[model samples]
Target: MVREHQYEAARFLWGEGAIERMGEVLAAAGVDRAMVVCGEHVGANEELMDSVENALGDRHVHTYTGARGDTPLGTVETGVETFEQHDADGLVSVGGGSASDTAKAISVFAAEEGRTLHEMKTQTTDDGESHIPDLPAPKTPVFAVSTTLSAAEVSNIFGVTDEKAGDKVVILDEKIRPRVCVYDPAATATTPASTIASTGMNALDHAVEILYSDGHAENPFYQATAEKAIDLLVTNLPAAVNDRDPEALAAAQLGAGLSGFGIVGGISINHGINHPLCARHPVSHGDGNSILLPHGIRFTYDAVPERMARLAGALGVEVEGGKATDEATLEAMCDVVRELQEEIGVPYRLRDVGVDRDDFEAMAEIAAHDSAMANNPKRVTASDIVALLEAAW
Candidate 1:
């Protein structure tokens, strides 16, 4: 067993009634100026914004509504400008992962030294990596009011696609984690059913991958948390996707947080293969994972059969008997995932989402080298990734 202990950031308030407690944490953290982030496309929930404003009394409260989908360099700069223009002391993120990720990038850029944004881009880090770090020092605290079930709050990690570089970059550090995660299920009322389903599926992949990850045996706490998260998401996500009921939404958000926390700590091959899908194709983050998850599970069956069996049960597939062969268990589990994707309207094949064979080799090559690939349960080769892509195709 390989054990490399890791610490996840954020003080969280999960479940119902958590949103009301945001003021206390904000006050305690000494956030004198708070800027709440939202996407320009996000419908203004004035009442909720007003409530947040009222909660942080005697402090400057502002709305930042420029975050758009796709984390290109342009959007990153816009987010950074929003922070510095406001001279914000506290960052409160609203909307989904795009907005949340944008907020984190803004904080990163704002903390950097005297290098202008233009100079920063041309100058990669000393390690020959792209993008300049927040080299000067730390910036203000980040607080997230997550309306969607996709957990972007607890993790210090943020995923952005460098359009110019033609790849998605996941930045990690303790500073990027939200100081507090305010989960208001009511805030999710307006999210499209499609978005909910895709993101929920992504969360499921996170939890499941971690369960079959490298250090699971040596890290009981991480493995246990991941197991529970998978259980909760599989139990609640379908209802949350189908209906907008407040209770169901709350349950889904809670499950998402659990799963998000799990994957943020450790992930595997599905994302290694799926990231390229999102980068090159016009697929939602969750749908990208949904398309690849079953195949990933199939790939790992020989290595982690028992855990795969449990996933099968959580996904509502009958195992016939616990004594069944691992291959049989794996087939049953993949079938369960396939059926759920069909039921929830997530596309199970890349063809259904309009991906063609023209760039299959290119995509596979990038996936095999992706940082996520290194943490996979089973060591993967470019050919293995190509095979999975062909299966999905």
Candidate 2:
């Protein structure tokens, strides 16, 4: 059992044009000589760069524009090299999960001055014990400008891909959490609707998994926040996707941020299943979650029916009976999630995406041993994981 967990409470700023205030916040935090880590799209936009330069004003800025999905280890080294070349004192990550994750990895490497990237990578044992190094010195701070609902901006931990092993590596350190996060709906305007919709599902996965997490029940604060995050995400995701309303977009961003707050409590089978699916296939993280969520909920619902009922209520599903059986309530919640995915045009079945049937057994084996699976509300075996993958297919 986990006890006395800590939450990363970064200073959050949100609004329509909130990103324009980056210069003011940076100056107040006494940060100068900052390195900007961005995605290929944002990195190439001269207009966006102008805005960034305008915000930084006279502060020294270095740009590293090589972030990609699944934060590659080489990208982290590149970001560190850029930071050192510019003598950067801080970082500004401008994109979604990949960009923010790269910045976090850079900070981790920066702290251990002489350590190689491979040496700094986290190592996990068969028993799930992780050997993470300690950073006694204050590390460089990161300021995030979020352009998607992925919510990596608020996390203390980030995932990087190990090219040699062909697997994802997760790193944890509170010092990697961003010092300031700017959530401007306008910034996400240039992002594709499909990407936004898919990432929203990823954020939804965070909230739902936290609600059913074994560790979350230990913290009433996390419970309440998870519920609120669920409500906001369910109501706003479709609006943000279909209408493209700035207000709805802002609300979705806030919902993503709130969902991240409870993530330290834990994740569940949905994430466990999706991580391996994404790793094996080219599927986006959110799309994989969107596909596997209903199946994951059904697998765990029998163990925690009352909580499933509460979650169904939060999603505004109309329960047929006030005293509906746990099984009925569980089915209802799963249906609601499926309906939302369909409405938002996200893939609801693994087959609808490019997931290969031949890979089900292999994916399940990997998912069974994933680090996130430890927090699942119900005990899961390799057989159970394979069954879920088959059902999703």
Candidate 3:
């Protein structure tokens, strides 16, 4: 089989005090005035904010703290308004996925005037074909300082929830990719343990899906990065959350960043389902990933059994006699993931996270249309999604 892959690499500065170099990064990017984007909790952290302000120096123009979970469309609108009011030339995202996604959304909306988010967002037809409109306008550069493991900073994709429609609208634009990313473990230290744990699982899910996602499965570069990401997450996630070890957290952060490589290839059904699950419910994207990943693995196992079995080695699971049947290896892989989730105190069941069994059908309908579904190694139907949801529940 012949395959071609396209990947974009982002400049990353990682270390204990990497945030202090924000000014140099901004200067190199020719961004004179930058707005800091973050969630309320992050905004209230005076110490962290102080660090960011000092690092950015005179280049920091304003702070928009209205970023919310699910990257609500209204919040993005507010961010764009704030950006224009302050006359900012770039965005510096300083928190988790929501903050990064909000900044990405603002960059797009601010650049392309006269178009509503609904009009620019990726849309699905009645027959289930998805379309992403070309966003040719140049966007404001984004510099991300990640404080969670969601790794939204490195990808050109972002999701915004349509409050009325109760669905997440995904957008893809190459220009929205961050100009630079800072992975300071100290920046993540202030985030809650539960968030770190759940998002760590989310990063692991990204690596797992990449191994078998369409086109990517055959690409050796994607395979190597995904495997290394899995190994790093499996080894360091528990200590990062439980003991708050700086070294361990650094490794976990690198793992999360590497997992974002999946975006260049594609993600599979787990992320496709997680998008709607987070949009419709109070669940965090990380929690959604935590709960759905095992079921997604099982759902797609038969189609990519050999690739699935390879995950066991990456997960540090030792097979008996150095080999096992694919079915047995699959079970071992799931067991390893579930045990890691338990160790990290992330939810492993949909019911535990307040997901209603009755809403499964609607969630399935929306998930079936997600762009990530197009890359699933196995052909997936709405009915298949429903069954997976039921099993996870």
Q: What is the TM-score of each candidate against the true structure?
A: 0.87, 0.91, 0.95
List, residue by residue over 292-385, the lDDT tens digit for candidate 2: 8888778887777556665677777655443335566777788779888988899888888888989888777766766677677787777898
lDDT of each: 0.71, 0.79, 0.87
Measured with C-alpha atoms, the lDDT of residue 41 in candidate 3 is 96
Query: Considering lDDT, which of the candidate structures 1 and 3 is the better prediction for this target?
Result: 3
Give the lDDT ranking, best first: 3, 2, 1
> In terms of TM-score, how similar is model 2 to the real structure?
0.91
User: What lDDT is reached at residue 133 by model 2?
Assistant: 55
Cα lDDT tens digits, model 1, 68-171, are 66565577777778777877888878778887887887787777645443333312232322343444467678888787666766677677676655556566
Residues 323-351 of candidate 3 have per-residue lDDT tens digits of 43467777878998988988999998888
Screening candidate 2 with a backbone cut-off below 3 angstroms (N, C-alpha, C), the clashing residue pairs are none
Q: Which stretches of candidate 2 lie above 4 Å from their native place?
A: 1-6, 113-137, 318-325
